[model samples]
Target: MDADVTDSAGTPADPDHRAGDTPQGRSQEEPGATDSTDGSEPVPQKDAPQDETPQGEATDADAPQGSGDEDKAESSDENKADREADGTGAQTWADHPKDGSASRRKRPWLRWAALGASFLVMISAGAGWWLYKKLDGNITTDTSAAAELKVYEKERPTPVVMDAQNILLIGSDSRSGDNRKYGRDDGGSQRSDTTILLHLAADRKSATAVSLPRDLMVEVPKCRTGDDKETREQFTQFNSAFELGGTACTIRTVERLTGIRIDHHMVVDFNGFKDMVDAVDGVEICLKEPIDDKDARLELPAGRQTLNGEEALGYVRARKTLGDGSDTERMERQQRFLGALVNKMQSNGVLLNPTRLYPVLDAATKSLTTDSGLDSLRDLYDLVRSMRDVPTDQVQFLTVPRQPYRQNVNRDELVQPDASELFKQLREDKPVAVVPADELKEKEKAQDEKPDDTGSDSESPTPTPTYSGSSAADDLCEQ
Candidate 1:
């Protein structure tokens, strides 16, 4: 039987942290043996819960009796060392498992995606606001026109259809600034090169554009000019109103001629027109013959080709070189080119895409001069938004019925009943049916040649009067 052993202070010896580090029978191997260094006792394992404890740890219960402050200090130091060696219970974002074979979760990827989406949303919001302000600032408000029109409010015709809209689009020919390269300024008098009356139906299903002849004789009402002087009302050439009294005069003349209230107006300059065409990457046209016009600055091979900004402006503005060289035919070419442009925009979804639409709006607004009603970006947005869904076929382009004036062969006069009838339909927001002019003429010629099968002289039922016009849906390539 082994005799019980005790240390010098009469205290029992305890186990080492790792069992048998200093063998339990060391004393038996050497009788009356004591620790040679400081005669102090080592820590016991009872201070820490063994199962729950990390490796190389100690607890207060394991501390020796009469251990005092010296033994407690030794136990505390061991506990701290264990924590450092085994790793504290804290992790960082950069931390990863030390094992090479451990798999990573896809949760991090999901977090990354959410962060990217939020960043994109914030960028889009900021970009949208900036674009809105830019487009708004680009528009030049026609305050003078608005003010002058207000002065003549009593003489202005009242709007017939409250929801329907009538807007006058004028192409300005002022030889100033960038346009000086095209022609001499001629004392800076502004002229209306092209004027189209655009009517939007209350249902937002149809839009009609009527091209008014510049040389057509029309009655001009009294108008205020830049000098604040009023011009006498007289029967004169339609475009003279613009040269004499600017947009206000032109608006008064159109209002008087059609007897339809003008809701808003936009005057686009030559430079703007070219820029807008380039914005859409040019418009495609199928020319019957090749064009080479020096004055117009256009030279292109015919048969299914695209026209850039400069070429397009020349094509639309060149009068003496295309077709019969008459302003009448020139107007027709303008209508066809406009139709192709509209088709390009709708077919390519430019209006629906913000990125694609911005450049076009930017180019257009830079040259646009509009009334107070349309100067704001939101106002213009609402206007285009209403017409965005209108079918291409419903967007009609036509010329007011006109014939060479009997007195002056160089001038034009409106054909009696047709012009009045067209204006009446627009005023009432009624649908005016239209057919291609060539097709209509061909039908008339065919009818005249073919013998009538019906022998009855009895009058047939009156049919709807379809106007001779073209729509954006008309394919120039097919023609």
Candidate 2:
């Protein structure tokens, strides 16, 4: 008996294992092995059953285990190729590091914020343009004035210096249309209730407002009416030119009187004046006595008080009830009221607030009938901008010196040398000698108290010529 031979699994092994024979008792053969001297033919042994399944009849469980790993690797390679083809292989937001994600998240929000800001800017710009157009349209232009002025353009005086400006401001008392409620409405004749020649210095440091009395006797030149009717030239009241013609004739008369070129003119009617006063809320005025005037429709008690539009108009117009009843005294009152008004407008925060400013502008533009040069919004804006920085104290108001006419006490005549001197100074763009009323009083007091220095005949400093008027900085209500 051979030693009991067994396989590793304890199964019975082949009996001819040492003989190198097949299980069927045939000789075993190997590749390249030499055969023994016994003449037996070599035979091949049968292979063990393979684990593979038949073709086209295999299940997932029957597939080799390594095949599953190969399938998984192939799928991963295909996914990588798709990512690279889509150009998102390493740049996908989700795959980014923590810091990159934070920055990436902010990008969209920043873009949206910028877009929102741009939209707001566009809206604001559109609103501003609309507002400008609306304000611009409110102004009324007098084409007739331009046409009339052109006829006399050659006769008008030339400017003495550059950058000097003269503007004729006419307050028209037209009892027509809305103004009919204020005064007599005879046909449509309008007269200049107030005339002011505003001279702006070439250096822009000083401003002078010279008020012309309506009762001043002056030579009225030939002028054509609105209907092409021509009036013969005659000596008449200064404001009679406006009654005969309109703004053009009035400008011509002023030009002839002062020999100063009028660069522009503005005519404001009664109703418009009231609206302006109302827009600024009211102007403060002081009254020495109680006033109850039926002609002017003003009723107010004594003391400092704020006057409404109607009251203000009445206050300015009430001559007999408020003062010595002379037109001169009335003019002085008008100057004081205007000075207070200027002070109020400059110091009361009106220009700084849009809400307050718009109404004032609206009332002012609508109230004005301007010459062609200053008809447009841009022209008016430029004019106002140029003078916005002028100091209130430098804004001086004075009447052209006048006295009772030789023939009539009601009429006025310009004082000879003083009036000519004032006109020459204005025409030459020279500074007017104007000292504040209080300062002049103080100087007079000092002169009374001090002794004259007669021993040393030293030349005195040229005194700044003083005029009788009030500055815008002066307080009208002060005792």
Score every model by TM-score: 0.75, 0.75
Off by over 4 Å in 1: 1-123, 442-462
Per-residue CA lDDT of model 2 for 100-186, tens digit only, reads: 433556588888999999999999999988888887888899999889888888988888888989999999888888888887899
> Which lDDT tens digits does candidate 1 get at residues 53-128?
2222333354346643664343334444553555542222123233212122425676699999999999999998
Which residue pairs in model 2 clash with each other?
Answer: none
> What clash pairs does model 1 have?
47-59
Relative to the true structure, candidate 2 reaches a TM of 0.75
Model 2: residues >4 Å from true position, as ranges?
1-112, 435-462
lDDT against true structure, model 2: 0.78
